[model samples]
Target: MRSKIYNAPCERESVRLLRFAAATAALSALAVLAPATASALPAEKKPSPSVVDVHDSELTDKQIRDFWTPERVKEALRNPAKAPATRAARSRTATSPSPSPDLAASAPARGFAADAARSGANTAAGLSVSQEVPAGAGNNIVGKLIYVSPTGELTHCSAASIVSANKNTIWTAGHCVHEGDGSGEAGWSKYVMYYPGYSRGADPVGEWTAARLHAPTAWTQDGDAYEADIAAVVLNPRLDGNLEDVVGYAFGYLFTENRTDYAGAAVMGYPAEGYQRSDLDGERLMYCAGDTTDAFPLNPFDDRIKLDCDMGRGVSGGAFVWGPQNDPRIVGAASHVALDDAGQRVSDDLFSSEHGSYAAALINTVNNEG
Candidate 1:
């Protein structure tokens, strides 16, 4: 087993440990997203994230306290440092063209912003993919998860379905369930679980417990920590709702089917505030680009899966669908961040691939559980 580092909230002046995690790494993932500072800095300038003043609105300690009620305070206490350590270089399990060594050498290993610096921060593109509905009832898809510490604190992440209502499973990153390689798995984290379509932290349907949490064991064991950082939860109580019975299923892609033509795709799901991730389904539907690409050290060889979709804190596990055309389907998902040669961090994309068998396996797990 690898040594796990846990993060607390940002109760201090600086951004608390936003994982880029599970960046468990909003900040952690973005460590690589920002333009690299090492080479950019005057050789003598201290090599670190430049704290340029920005009109950024982070959660107030009071707000966090109120949002989480009692548990958040304890998490705040555990994470005392202004920042944790991010990898000097992003780590990747598979191969894309080798990144400019300049970018490779300076990736932040681990630190705050593990959520890759999130805030309803969303980016996406305009594309199209195929999706299907499971006929009848409510065939909607959604993401779900739980945050717990050894101290017994809890929170939640969100998710969405791309496969229409055919199955009762939801697709999301692995970290959403177990805290992935970096933080969520720390001893401080008790049990990490997910619930689909859970709004306001409550299950709109019957509150179903995870019969099983399925993900790439590699990510679970760090095979390609960030690459195969995907997972799915098998709902113990199958989805009783269907398309006709409910609203409708969100469109998405085929399992493990790669659609490189996804230049403009739509990503949707419940966000931090929960529910459709928007007050009016409009904001909830995030559209990104197919030409999305930057240099991220962690998962270097990305095959063009990047976007700029807006999602708040609660929107962790959502679907990166490929469009509003006829039937849009999911192509990729918001996994983590990447660093360029300059050490700038940016959001990344995660899709099914050679090392992505685990992702499909997870999907199977959900099918079996259902």
Candidate 2:
């Protein structure tokens, strides 16, 4: 396997490791959401996803921990940079066109900010109140992800743990792991790491590094295909056991055959905006709860399941859950923030590609491999 180096960032003042007492105190004030429900269309009988083994970060566990120090994490959280790596460069060739200005526009507006406020759901776009996950219910299901883009910039996104045979697979958006546009260093991300139960600056469940990645060919080939914008990653087990075992839980996925509507659903992510977030800095998991609707012709590139939640940029790979709260199934991931007619992202109008046979096959292949 080809390996990529995590280009180190400029050094800064060192921050101390997390304290258990502080974490416990913070957890006391966090509020968890109820069970998830959603409407969905049945999955089409398509062939398995054309899986592509993408880039490998190749960093050791200690290196990952050391690289993402509290200082760096604080910087990322306080002022999270938008998608800088994916901005297609301005090409000079006659046939090659310059990267569209819209591609580099700010993240879409938070999904359902207005409707949510009117309905008494939190205005920042999730659940009925503060977006923090309950103390223990979301320990393993959601976490903060850090990675180096192809051009070598440090950035973060949200990701989730999934039930896999190897017991070490994670699910996230395709753009989170690879340069979906197929440009950049080796066309893949480097030094990718996931920190479950990462609150404030503490990693309660330890860090999981990416050993291998699997993405749909459609994304790797061009990056514009939203329907095929999901990815699965196999992680190196830490301390002699897998991540799910360490955190005590993992989530399942769903692939219905016909389109369906949900009465209610929960969308969980690590967002840096839409709340009193100076403390958490994208460290604690937050959620938006509401019904889902179809927004088929909005983007033209993919048929998205429109939700009235206010999730924004940093939560790109967070899970959209349907079913019982304690044991919900993931039907899709927070893909791209849907863009409005003026080319700005619509935050309250969150969108996710319908997970189907292709996603199932991709996850199965990654877990079964080796």
Candidate 3:
């Protein structure tokens, strides 16, 4: 569970994003109570996992290969000018002063091959899991693992993967972004950033400045972080020139809305949680296999994609795609699921069309937005 609005300063603004939004709700709005929707999924007789629709007759089901990946998702960014309005949510991090940007420099080819190779190898050799993280990420109130404030405080700041052109880019679960004092606000901590492949205090791996941030507008304007539960971020100048190139952007889904055959799907992220994003138990590489249901009220609880992938507070805004690096076609993101019910926490798989846009429309946004 994550503390909503650890960052209190932006509480007022974040309230605007909430559902029954009021003037100054504390973490109550953004803070997630365990099982946001009290619908205990209740343990039922064991059943075989359902298969998702992988091949579409309308569109050729391209053989997802080893080259597909979350890093390469940025290829869609080619349409920088046409990206979606979703990018606007990032305004908080981008407009802030002092967090400062490096005078734009032509991207260098330094360490591209060496770094990408290392990242690939590391991922291939990383832990493996039998379960998957839930489908969403955000500020939960119960069982919180960490806490971060709008003032750059980091008792529990959510982590994101940086993938900016300057290499100053990162992705985090959405809760870390909108929970200004737990009101699901848009403003984030000023000095906030991420520690990639973060291990204990060592902060030994890569570090980048939070020059820009982007999450779905739902999270920023409507406090509906649960809906778009994904985010993109830009790094500081350090990414301009680095040893390891850092990871690339996550690819968009092959479809605009939801697709299926995702039972064996894979996802990866530096979930600041003690458990690995993959583990069926806590703390292991998480794997996913479940069904998505319709969206409901209370806790937005409905038939979204369901999964038993164990996740903690930090895994929000992470990517849930087809085989991750191997088959980078993004299928869904981590939405919340209720565990006490026994179905385990089921994750919803949101697609480009779920928001009623075509694949290219989303591509257009990624390419055009500033």
Candidate 4:
């Protein structure tokens, strides 16, 4: 199978698109663990699945925090063309089995009302396909994640703080944290930092650096499998407290959910391109809400869901949320854009791996080991 996979990341001028054949590999079975709850789980007692792979940034928190100066961040925003490109190996063709019914779980968000007070209204031009997240809507949980790629390019992707036992874990796409397991390309990102409530370079909630990054072996070891494109980051605490405490909210999780559960769901991020809108420069929060459809039914090995969204690069790793606007649960992270046979992006479609047992296992590993 041939496909053009563009994992979104924003930098200086052009979007990084990877093209490769598809490889057939079965999804690995994850060790069962109890579902997470709103309360923190016991760190020493919980057992996580072995399928999760952890990558330590290996830099001092200060080193990571001090690298992103105002000027450097401005450069990252201005260039828009220097983003690192990963030449992933052939895509994996694998069937991801459904998780046990008992694995379905969720946790509530915290600190939203307080953070909304600090958020400002969206100021970018609107597109017919997506609208700016309303001001003071408590969507501060979603933000931008900036990091230096192994190739030394400064880039950014959308991410969100999630309710976790440690209260410091955030969710994003696997490609946001590690280049795919392609020859001469597999590696972790560097100087990872997250800016919650980021708008046009404004850091309303301050910045948090990653203490550790986690992705499934299927993404880091096997070919860059779309079904395992989810990742998590454990953040170092700020001077005041954890990320969710400072941002005033973290999105809840909805694991083991299917495409049917995402009707009227919202996919949000900072998109630098899409809908042919010149005003979209990855500076503000945008969202497209609608029903979703199976992206690959004939393959059976790929269970990603696609939304009728026009969000493009920089939206990768953003949250796909369900439920009421006031209280949303994250079902998946933005993974990639489907491309036509001509090798151009299918602008109307955004894809995400359905969150299931692998996601739960990854989160549990981060909570216990990170």
Top TM-score prediction, candidate number: 4
C-alpha TM-score for every candidate? 0.48, 0.69, 0.45, 0.78
Q: What is the descending TM-score order?
A: 4, 2, 1, 3
Better of 1 and 2 by lDDT: 2
Q: Model 1 segments beyond 4 Å from truth?
A: 1-140, 149-153, 162-166, 182-206, 223-226, 238-252, 255-261, 270-301, 310-313, 323-326, 338-356, 368-370
What digit string (tens of lDDT, one per residue) describes model 4 on residues 1-370? 2333465411001111221110000000001111223454433323245466787778889998789888777765553222223322224352223234234456654442212211111222122276677554255577888887766778888898888877788999887788755322347888898888788778777888998898876666553444567799999987899876666566767666343234556678888887455677889888876655566555444456666678777888888766432345677787766556675764677777656656777776766664
Q: Which prediction has more favorable TM-score, 2 or 3?
A: 2
lDDT of each: 0.33, 0.53, 0.28, 0.62
Off by over 4 Å in 3: 1-147, 151-167, 180-186, 200-204, 239-244, 247-255, 269-303, 324-327, 339-366
Indicate whether candidate 3 or candidate 4 has the larger lDDT. Answer: 4
Better of 1 and 2 by TM-score: 2
After superposing candidate 2, which stretches have Cα over 4 Å from the reference? 1-50, 78-130, 256-260, 275-281, 297-302, 340-343
Residue-level lDDT of model 3, residues 1-370, one tens digit each, is 1212111101001001101111001111111112211111112221111100011111111212122233332221111111111321224443211111111111111111211211222222212222332322111111111223344334333333321223334444444444312232325423344444333232334344444445544444433322233444444445245312323222323322322224333444323332233322222223323322233213321113323343443444444443222212343444333322342223322211122122112222322333
Query: Once model 4 is optimally superposed onto the true structure by TM-score, how far is the C-alpha of residue 21 displaced, in angstroms?
Result: 39
